[model samples]
Target: MIGGFGMWELLIVLLIVLVIFGANKLPEIGSGMGRAIRNFKKATGEPEEIDVTPENEKKKEEGEKKE
Candidate 1:
């Protein structure tokens, strides 16, 4: 068993996914998940640099109107 999943079990799960999403879309799904994981890891290592809120947006709009 690999990671508590037998080969047959893994194959069956893959077949079900293939039936649901079809063979055509698997690469797209895989790449999107890969990107999401990469971005999540990158975000974890960085400090948040800005906050944008409704109040801040309104103030900026007002300032722009005055200018």
Candidate 2:
């Protein structure tokens, strides 16, 4: 009774998916789905924090001086 879907219902859905996609394509499909979910999370997630310590600033300044 997961999310209102019984075990049999879930098994039927999985069977249908397997039949449609074929066994050979299942791994590729799974990896593509994983990548899609990962990208979706990254797109909606917050911006990364910047580190602005004095050491980092000094390195930047040294690089600029070299240029």
Candidate 3:
């Protein structure tokens, strides 16, 4: 086993992710992961949620339009 994962097992998983998302998109995936965890914590009543709301959704749409 390598790093507690069987040799080549992690490589296989990473290859699958690369095939699915491509290398150029990995940073976008990581940022999305951060956003998902932040939202989950806020839903569970964490001290901060970064303001998730329908209003935020509307604002997002508006922001996209402005771009």
Candidate 4:
């Protein structure tokens, strides 16, 4: 029941996300979440940090180009 989204509620939420993002952008969203989580851990002074994969690196690069 996190954020008013329960287990089955999450599946319904995911379906909405799938409709909005489509299959192509879904992978990008997942990777972006991973990088955000990594950066968050670093900012919080967590001893262990997760590495962002190459796919995430490419997505970040694309976003920077748009700025």
Candidate 5:
């Protein structure tokens, strides 16, 4: 059971979603949901797990080290 709801209940909800949105829209929907969650976390002041520095910044740092 997931959060007290059984697997079948989850499946039913998924089916309803599929019927409402169709197959093609699912990926876009999922990505939008992910962005929403990420934004919400940021708004709540949660620290990100991974800090991504841009490639140009990394190259500059390496060049400075070499000089």
Candidate 6:
């Protein structure tokens, strides 16, 4: 059991999430959660190097490079 949650307990929580958010929205939720985690780590001074660029800015740079 990780973090005091047994396998069955974790499964139940996941089921609840699936019901509430549905499968289509799960990926979006996961990505947003991943971004939040990365930001939290950066804020704590644990990782000295990180890419802080917004997605649109990166896409713009790529477009300019290709032109």
Give the whole-model CA lDDT for all candidates, comma-separated.
0.94, 0.93, 0.88, 0.91, 0.92, 0.96
Q: Over the full model, what C-alpha lDDT does candidate 2 score relative to the true structure?
A: 0.93
Q: What C-alpha RMSD separates each model from the true structure? A: 8.2, 7.1, 14.2, 17.1, 8.2, 12.2
lDDT of 5 at 39: 94
- List candidate 5 stretches off by more than 4 Å: 46-67
**Winning candidate number (lDDT):** 6
lDDT of 5 by residue, 1-67 (tens): 9899999999999999999999999999999999999999887896656559999999999999999
How well is each residue in 26-45 modelled by candidate 4, as lDDT tens digits?
99999999999999987889
As a whole number from 0 to 100, the lDDT of residue 42 in candidate 5 is: 82
Off by over 4 Å in 2: 47-67
**Model 2 — which ten-residue stretch has the worst lDDT?**
44-53
Clashes of each: 0, 0, 0, 0, 0, 0
Give candidate 5's whole-model lDDT.
0.92
Pairs that clash in candidate 4? none
Native-to-model Cα distance after best TM-score fit, residue 39 in candidate 6, in Å? 0.1
Clashing pairs in 1: none
- Candidate 1: tens digits of C-alpha lDDT, residues 1-67: 9999999999999999999999999999899999999999999989878655689888998999999
Candidate 6 per-residue lDDT, tens place, 27-54, comes to: 9999999999999987897766779999
- Sort by TM-score, top down from the best: 6, 5, 2, 4, 1, 3
Please write out the lDDT profile of model 3 over residues 1-67, one tens digit for every residue: 7678985898898899999999999999999999999999878885554656688798899999999
Superposition error at 21 for model 5 (Å)? 0.7
Model 4 spans > 4 angstroms off: 1-4, 46-67
**How does model 6 fare in lDDT?**
0.96
